[model samples]
Target: MILFKKKPWKLVTITSTLIFIIFVVLVMASIIIQISNYKFDKSQAKRNEYIISTSLLNSGLSFEVAKGDINGIESIINDYLSYKEIHAIEVRKLTREVIYRKQKTINKELRIVAKTYSLLSQYDEISIDGLDKVENKEVKTIAKVVITFSSNYMNKKITQQALFTGGLLFIAVMITIFFLYLFNRYIYKYLNNIINTMNSIKQGDNITLKNKGIYRVEELNAIYRSLQELSETIYKRDAQLKDSLNQAMEAKILAQEAEQFKEDFIRAISHDIKTPVGVIINLISMIVEQSDTIKDNPSLSEKVNACYESSIVLKEIMTELFNFEEFEQQKLIENKTKVNLNEIFSQIKSLYETKFSEKGLGFSVYKGSQQTTQLLYYINIDKGKLLLVLENLLDNALKFTESGAISITWIVKKDSLLIQIKDSGIGIPEDKYKVIFNKHIQLNNISTSTHQGRGLGLFYVKRIIDLLGAEITLSSKVDIGSVFKINIPITSTMSTNTENTLLLTEELSKSNFKALIIDDDQHTCFTLTEMLNKYGIETASENIPEIGLSQMTKESFDLAFIDFHMPNLSGDVIMKKLTSTLPKNTTFYVCITAESSPYHLEKLDTLFHEVLEKPFDITDLQAVLQKALKSKRVTNEVINNIKGKS
Candidate 1:
C-alpha cells in the first residue's frame, strides 16, 4: 500500500504490465483449448453410439429380426441399454410394427438416438468343402434397431473438467502476478534507498548505511559499502580541517599579542629616554641663556653653544624615531577642538626663532594683514596634527635655507584658512615636487651641510594634512626659494576676547607663592627648585610619592608639579588621591612627563589642571607659573564673591 502511494518506477511498471498481459493471454488460450475439447467430446460421443448400434446389428440381432425372433432382438437391446449412456433401445418390423421395445423414463429433451436397419437376406456359403465362399447381395430392410443415449451426463462431465482446469490456470496467473509485484517492490526499495543515500551525500550530510547487509543484490551491496567508506573519509577530513583551523586561529591570536607587547615596550623605552634628553636640552639652554656671563669668553661660549646645538639635534633624532614608530603603528587619531591659529603660529615661531638665529637665517611669522589679525584666527581643527605639520615644514625649511629668510604667513578667509611657509632655500625641481613628499625621498643635488635629515619630515607633513582633510600645494624655482601653501576648510569659527596679560613683577615675585614639587628624579626636582628660587618663590621637593602626599597634607601650596612616572605610585593615581582628599580647585596641579603619546596625554589631561611636557625650558616654566597664578586669582575672586553674597 505504501509502495502504491509512490510514483511507480518505469521499469517495474512496464515489466509488470507485460507479465500481466502474458498471463491473461495464457489463461485465454487455456480456456479456448478446454472449450474445443468439450466440442470434440460431444462429437466423439455421437460417433461411439453409432458404432455400437452397427456392432449390435452385425452380431446376429439382424438375423434374429429376419427370423421374426423379437425376443432375441429385445435381449440384445436390453443388454446394450444396461450402459449408463444408453437410455432406451427398440426393434421394429419391416412394416414398421414394433417387434420389441425397451425404454427408460429419461429426459427426452436431453436424449439423442442412433438407428441402424438390419437386412433380411442371408449370405450363401458355397461348397468346396474346405473353402467356403460368401456371396454378397443387396438386402431389403427387414427390422431396425434404434439406440437412445443421454448426452446430459457427458456434457456435465466435460463442463466440470473445463471449469476445474480454468480455475487452476486462474489461480496460477494470480500467484505469478503477486510474486512479480513483490519482486518489483523489493528492487524498488533497494534502488530508492541507494538514491536517497546518494542525495544525502551530495548535500554534505554525514550519512551512514545502517543496514549494510540489507541489499541482497551484489552490485547494490558493493555500492553501499563504497558509500559508507566515502562518508567515513569525509568525516575524518572535516574533523582534521576543523582542528587545523582552530590551531591557526590560536596562533594568529598569539602573534597579535606579541606584536602588541613589542609596541608597548618600544613606547615605554622611548618615553624613558625622552625625559633625560629633555632635561639635558633644557639645562643647556638655561646655561646658554646667560649671555652676559658667556659673552666675555668667546671660546667657552662657542663650545657651550655647540653643545646646546648637538643636544638639540640629539633630541630631534629621538623625536623623529618616536614619530616613525607612531606612523608605522598608525596610532594617530583625529581629535579636533577649537584652537587659535594665532597662538599656535606664535608658539611655532618662538620654538624655531632661536634655532634660525643660531644658523644665521632670518625667521618671522606674519599673521596676515591688520584686518585679518583683528578678525580672530580661531577655527575647529586637530591642534596636535596642525602643530606637527607646521613644525615639520619649518624644520625642513630651516635645514635647507642657508642665508635667506624663512617665514610663516597665514590669513583667515570666509570659508577657509590659508597658511604659507616660504623659505629662501635651494628650491626643488618641478618634477621632484610630488616625489619629495614620498617617504624616504631626498634631493641629492641640494647640500644639507651639517643638518642631516631622515627624509620623513615632508612625508609626515603630507600624511597629517591629508588626515586633517586639508589641501597642501608647493611652488618652487631652482635656487630661488620654495613655498608650501596649506588651505584648510573651516566648518566653524570663533572669536577670542582680550585678557590682561599676567606680568611677572617684583611685587608678584615677593608675594610668597610657595610651590610643591613631587618627583622621583632628584635632578628634575633640583632644576625646578632652582628655577622657582630665581623667581623668589619658595619650593619644596619630594623624591617619594608618599612623602609628597604627606607634604601636601601639611601645607596648602598654591602650585604643585608632579612627575607622572614614579616607582611607588604613578602620577594618575596620585592625582586621583589628591582630587578625592584635597579641596576642589585648591592647588593648581601640573603633570610633568616625557610621554607625548596622545592616549597618555589625553588621560593626563583629565587628571591634572595642566600637563607640562618634560625637558621644560625657562619659557615653559614661566607659562606654567602664569597659568597657575591666573587660576589662583580666579579662585580668590570667586571666594570673595561668595563671601559678599552671603
Candidate 2:
C-alpha cells in the first residue's frame, strides 16, 4: 500500500488521518477524564456517606443516648443505611462496641468493586454532645460514623459517557475528512492546476488557462495579468521588427532600381559609342589594307597604321567596358543549356588559331591526362559566356607569347570540369600573379609594344567566370610560363549535343519587314526607327504609349515593339489590350525596354511574343524581329484557315 505522493492527495490524506487520530486521542483522553471523574465521584460519594453517617450518629444517636431515647438513634441509622451508594454503615459508642451497625455486604475492612477499579471504605469519628448541658471540648471520641461507597454506582453512566464521546469523536473525524476532501477537490486541485500550468509553460508547452474560475485568488490573477502583458509586448515587438524589415527590403529594392537605371544608361551610351567607333576603326582598317594607293609616302602610311591601331584599341576598350558593366551589374542573365566541351573547344580553337597565326605563335587544345576515358565531357552552361572567358584567356596568351606554344588542356572529373590554358610565354612574377587578374594591371616583364588592351581582359574574364559559378587559379614563374586553370562544376554526366543559338528564322530573316517602335524617349524611338529603316524594315515611331497603341489600333503592322516603361500605360497593359481586341493575325507583341527584373521579365514573357532587351545590337534586334514575324505569320495562317472553314 503506497501513501499519496501527489500534493493534493497527500494533504487530504494527512489532514484527514491527523483529524482521525486526534479524535481518537481526544476520545481516549475523555475516557481517562471520565474514569478520573468516576474516581472523584466515588470520593465524593464516600465523603457524602461519611458526612451523613457522622451527622446521624453524632446528632441523632448522641442526643438520643443522652436523653435515653434509643429509638430515634436506631431510626436515623436505619434510614441512612438504606442508601444504595453506601455499601455498609456502622455507629459505635465510646465503649468501642458497635451500638448501631448496618451492612449491605459483609466486610471487615469494606471494599467496593466496579467493573475495572476498586473503592475503599471511608471512616470518620463523631463527638457526642449532651442535650442542654455544657459542652466538653476536650473529650475523646464518643461515637464513630463509618461509610463505604459502591464503586459500581456510576459505572453505567461513565460507560455511557465514554460511548457518547467515541460517537462524537467519530462524527468530528468524518466532518473534518469531508472538509479535507472538499479542499482537495475545490481548492488544492485548482492550485495544482496553476502549478502544473506554470511548469508546462516553463517547458514551452503552449497553453491557455482560462481565468474563469482559476482567478479566484487575487495574487494568481495578478501573475496571469503580468504574463499576458509580457507576451503581448513581445508579440508587438516582433511585429514591429517584421514591419521594419519589410520597409528595409522595399528601400533596398528601390535603390536597386535606381542603380539598374544608371547601368541601363551606361549600356545604351556604350552601344551608341561602339557602333560609330567600330565604323571608324573599320574605315581605318580599309585605309591600312588599301595602303598601296597611299604608299607614295611611307611616313603617312605608317601614321595611318598607327591611327588604325589606336581606333581599334579604343573599340576594344569600349567593348570590354561594356562587358564588365554587364557582368558587374548582373544585367546579362545566363541562358544555360547542355553543351559538348569538345565542340566549344573546337570553336575556341578555331577563333584563337586565326589570332595565333597572326601573331606567329603556336596554339593547340587537348584533353588533360587526368581525364578518364569513361567520362563524358558534357556540361550544362551558358555557352556564349563560357566561350567569352576562353576567348579572353586565349587572347591574353597570344598577346603574351611571342614564339612559344599556347596549350589548352581540359579534364572531365566526376563532379567538375578542369581546364588549364598554359602558355610558354613570359611568365608572370610570383607576387604579381594574383594581381594580374585585377583591372588595369600590367606586368613589368610583358612586352609593351603589342599590349593593345587596357589590362581589363583578365579582370573581365574573372568576373564572367564568377557569373558562371566557376573557379580560376593562375600559376606562373618569372621567365618560365603561366598556367591559368578553370574549374567548372558538372551537373550531369549524360552525353549531350552542343547548343546552337540560331534565332533568325525564314519569315523575318530578310530585313524587308514593317515594324512599330513605341518608347517614351524621343531619341530612343527615332534611333530605333532609323535602325529598322537601315534594315529595310518600314518602321513607325511613337514616343507615347497611348499614341503608339492608337496607331496600332488604326493601322496594323507585322510586328509591334512596345516599351515596358511608358508614360501612362505599361507594356503589359498594352499587351493585354492588344490581346483582347486586336486580331492575333494583325500584329505580334514584342517587349523592347530595359525591364530586367526577373519577376517582371517572367511576367512579360507570358504576354509578349518575345522580350527584346534595351541596348541590344543589330543581331539581337534581328533575332527578335524574326521571332515577331514568325508569330505574326503563324497567327495570320491560323485565322485565314479559320475564316476559310467558316
Candidate 3:
C-alpha cells in the first residue's frame, strides 16, 4: 500500500496491461463462438426442412397411384398448380421404353427430378402368360420424386440471423479492438509514464506528468482514473508531510527557547526565594540570640511567626509546582483510595468555617433526601486529588462572591452523582465556561479581584477529574450567580483501603531529624530547609556536591536530598559517593531533580533508596521522609498501613 502511494503510476500500468489482455482474449473468443454457432444452426435447420417436405410429397404420390385412380391422379396433378398448400409440384409418366417428367408447365421451374423402375420379379413366363396371369401384363411402374421449395420465411430468417450475427460479431470485435487500443494509449502509456515520473520524484526529481485522454478499454479506464486519484493523493500527502516537518522544526525551536526562558526564570526566582528566607532566618537567629531584650514584647514573637508563615507559603507554592509537574507528567505514584465524601467535606468545612465567617460569606450544605445526599456524601475517590478539586472550586467561589451566599447542593440521578456548588457572585460568561478549566484562561469577571491565582488551580482540578473519569458542568448568569455541577460515579473504588497515610506521616513529623540538601539551586535548598524546619528537622546544603564524600564523612545525616543535575557530578553520582563513604547501614537517599525529562527519572529510580522530586511540598516531603525513616525502623504494621492506604 505504501509503495503504491509512493509510485501509483507504476502499479497502474502493470495492473491495467494485464486486465486489457484478458478482456481482449475473452471478447474475441465470445465473438467467434457466437458466429460459428449461428451459421451451423441455420444450414442444418434448412436441410432438415427440405428433406421432411420431400418425404411428405412422395407419400402423397404413392397413395394416389396405388389406388389406380388415374383421373383422380390427373385431377390432383392439375390441382397442384392452383393449390397454395403445395410448396412445389412435379408429375411423371412411366412406359416400357422411357419415362417422362415435367414441373407443371411453369416457365420458371424449380429443380425437380423423377425416375421409374420395373418389377423384374415376374419373369418371361409371366410375360408370356400375361393373358392368363395378368391380362394386361403391363410393365410395373415406379416413380422417384424429388422436389425443391423456396422456404421464403425459413430462408429469410436464416439469412437474416446469419447476417445479423456476423455484423454484430464484427462490430463487437472492432469495438473491443478500439477500446483496447484506447486503453493502451490513453491509460497504460500515460500511466507508465506517470509511474516513471513518480519514481523520478521519489529519487528527487520533481517533474509533474501531464494529463492524457480517456482509455479505449473500461478496465484500463478504471486504472487511469485511479491513477489520477492516486496522483492527487500523493500530492496531498507530500504537502502534509512537508507541513508536519515544518511544524516539528518549529516546535523544536520553541522548546529550546522555552528551556532558556525557564532557566533564566528559575535563576531569578531562586534569588527571590533565598533573599527573603535568608533575611527572615537571620532575623530569627538574631532574635533568639537577643531573646532577653524582647522578653516582654509578645508581639515580636507573633511578628516572627507571621514572617515564618509567609516564607512557608512561598516555599509551598514552589513545591506544589514540582508535585503538579510530576502529576501532570504521570511520574508521581497515585496513592488512590476510596474516600468518604461526607467525612472529608465535613473536615474541610470545619477547617474553612472560620475563614468563611471572617469574610461574611454564607457557606452551607443542605442535607437533602438520603438518596441525593448519599451520592455527594459517599464516593470512592482519591482523597488528595478530591481535596484539591474542592479547594480550587471553593476558593474560586469565595474569591468571587462578596456578599451573596454560597450553597452546595447534591442531586443523585439514575446514572451519576451531581454536586452543584452555587455561588451568588459575578457569574462566568457562557463562552468562558468551556475555557475556564484550561490553564491561564480564567474567567474574565473573576480576574477583577486581588485573589488572582496561579491559573493552575482549575487546571489541576480538571486534571484530577479527568483522571477519575468524572463529568463536570458549569452554568452561570452575569452578575447573578454560577453553579458548577460535578458528577462522580458512585462505584469509583480506586483502592479498597480507607486508611489516611497523610495523617500517619503528620504524626511521624514530631521527631527531630537531620537531612542533607544537594541541589545546584540555592532557593530550592533554602525553601526546602525552611519547610522541613517546621517539622522539627534541620537541613544542611552541599551545593554542586563538590565535596560530597567529604561532607558525608564529616556529618552522619539521617537523610539526603540529592538533585539529579549538577555542574559535573550528578545526583546518582553523589548517591554512590554517599553509599560508599557513609556507614554500611545508611540508606537515606532521595533524588530531587528539576530536569523534568523522562530519562532523568528512570536513572534516578535505579540509584536512590527513595526519590523526592524538586519543588517539594511539606506534606509530600514529610511523607517521603517518614517512609525513609520507617525503612530503618522496619515496622510491618506501618508498611501494611502504607500499602493499604495506597
Candidate 4:
C-alpha cells in the first residue's frame, strides 16, 4: 500500500464498485419480485372465499350446515368444485370481539382447514350459567380460510432472473478486467521504454527517441519527444564545448612553437659568436706573448697568420649556423662537385693536429681498402657545407675525448660512402641514442669540465646528410664510448687537380705584378687594392661589373680576382663571359668568396687558377699570386716545346 500502486488500485476500485453496484441492483430486483408474488398468492387465496360462499348458496347448502356438515360440505364442494382450495370453512359468532361459536370441517377430498389465528373464546354450549344468554351482547358470523398453494413457478421465475442478472454482471466484470489488462500493458510498455532511455542517458550515452508514432498514448509520446529534444540539446552543447577545448589546445601549441623558435634564434647567435672571439683572443695572445721568446718583432706575417686562423674558425661557426637553418627549412640546394677525399682529410688532420697533441689525445684517420671503398678518387659533394658537417663532428669529438683516441674512418659501401667518427669518452646512454640527434637534446656527463655544444651539432649533421639523400646512425653505451656514422651517396666526378699553390710571402713583397680586382663591395675592392699595392703588386679595382669587364678586356693583365656575390650579375656569369671572350689570354682567373666553397671547389678549381675565401691572410694572397705565375711559366714552356716539335 505504501508503494502506491496507482494503476492497479484504480483498476480494482472502478471495476469492483461498478460490478458490485450492478450486483446489488440485480439481487434487490429478484428479491422484490419474489416478495410481491408471495403477497399476490395470499390475496388470491383470500378472494377465493367469496366464490366459495356463492357456490355454497347456489348449491342449496346453508351457512349453518357448512359449520358442522362434512357430508353437506362435501356435497357442496362436489357441486362447486371450482374452488380447488376450499378445504374447510368456519363460521364463528363473536360478541364484540369474543368468539362464540366456531366450526371446522374437511372437504370431500378429506382435506382439512387449519386456521392460523387464535380465537379469544371458543364455542361453549355450557356457559357460565349453563347455556344462558347474556343481555346486551351482539353476535355476528364470520368465516376463516385456510389456503395452501405450491410456489414452484414463482420461485423458479425469480431464480432464473437472478441467474441471468448475475451472469450479465459476471460478464461485465470480466470484460472490464480484460480491457484494464490491455491498458496496463500499454502503460507498462510506454513506461518501460522511457525508463530504458533515461538509463541510457544517465550512463552517458547519446540517445534519440524514435518510432514514437507507433505508441498509442499521446501524452506519453509527447513526454518522450520532449526528452529526445532535451538529449539533443545536451549533446550539441557538449560537442561545442569539446571543439572549443581542442581549439584552445591548438592555440597553446602554436604559442609554444613560437617561443621555441625565439630561443633557438638567440642560442644560435650567441653560440656562433662565442667560439670565434675566443679563438681571436687566444691567437693574439700567442703571437704577442710568445713572440718575445722568438727574438723578433712579430712580423706582419705572424700577425696575419693569427688573424687568418681566427677568421677560419669564425667563418666555420657562422657557416654551420646558416646550414643549420637551411637544412631544417629544406632550402639548401645541392651544388655537387668532385671532392678529393685525400686533400680534405689532410686539411682536417692538420687543422686539429696541434689541439690533439696539446690535449695528449691521439687522433687518427683511415681510408678503406680498394676492395672495400674507393677512397683515393675524388667524390662529388658540396665541399663547403660538408666541411661544416665534419667540423661539427670533430668539435664534438674534441669536447668528449679527454684521454682516449678519436678516429675518423670511411668505407665505401654500395651506392654510398660510410664515414664513422668514434670516440672513447663518457658515452651516452643506449636509450638516449635515438633522440641524441634531436636539437637541444644533450647529456650532462662527458669528458670536458664544460660541454661546449648546444646539442645542435648532431642535429645539423642528420639534416645535412638527409639533404644529401643519405642516412646517419649512432651507437653508444654509458661510460663505454659512442660512434656516429654517416652514409653519403657517392657523387659523380668530373675534373683533376689544378696548379699547386704555395705561400710566397717574401716573393710577394719583392716582385711587381699587374692585377685586376672586381668585387661588389666598394670597401672590399679598396682593401684589396691597398693590400696588393703593399705586396708590390700594381692593382686596379672596380665594384661595378661593366667597368671591371671593360678594364679586363682593355688591358692585358697578369691576374684577375672577382667576388662571387654581387648586386645583380653574379661572379660566375661575369667570369664565364669574360673568359669566353678572352680564351687565349694568359691572365689567371681567381674566385674570391666570403664563405668556403668546398662543396663546388673541385669544379671551381678547373675554372679558376685558385680560390680565395674572404678575410684572407697575406699568405693565402701570396699563394694565389705564386700559383698564377707558376702556371704562366709552365704554359710558356709547353708552348715553346710545341713550337719546336712543329
TM-score against native, each model: 0.60, 0.43, 0.48, 0.43
lDDT of each: 0.76, 0.66, 0.60, 0.63
Write model 3 residue lDDT over 374-481, tens digit each, in one string. 243345455556666777788778877777788776644554666778899888788887788887676655675565777777677787777767888888998898
lDDT of 4: 0.63
The worst-scoring run of ten residues by lDDT in candidate 2 lies at: 114-123
Residue ranges of candidate 3 with Cα displaced over 4 Å: 1-114, 117-332, 335-391, 404-456, 465-544, 553-565, 580-583, 590-606, 610-646
Residue pairs whose backbone atoms clash in candidate 3: 179-216, 182-216, 183-216, 319-615
Quote the positional error of residue 399 for candidate 4 in Å: 1.1
lDDT of 1 by residue, 1-646 (tens): 1133433442343445566779778787978888998898788776766566545645667678768776776787777877666777777777778778787775745646455556445544344332455546774566666666676667887889888988887787787779668767876887899899888876667887975434334455567789888877877787787799899999999989988887788767765786777677767776777567786889999888778777876776676777777777777666665566767787788678889998999999887564354544567787667877888899999888888999988887787888999999988999998899999888878635666777899999988888778899999998899999999887656554442123463434756688999999888888788778767788999999999988888788988999988998988998888878875648889998876677887898888888777656665676577677778788889999999999
Residue 458 lDDT in model 3? 69
Tell me the tens digit of each residue's lDDT in model 2 across 333-371. Answer: 665655657667875785467568667788888986754
| Residue 90 lDDT, candidate 3, scale 0-100 | 46
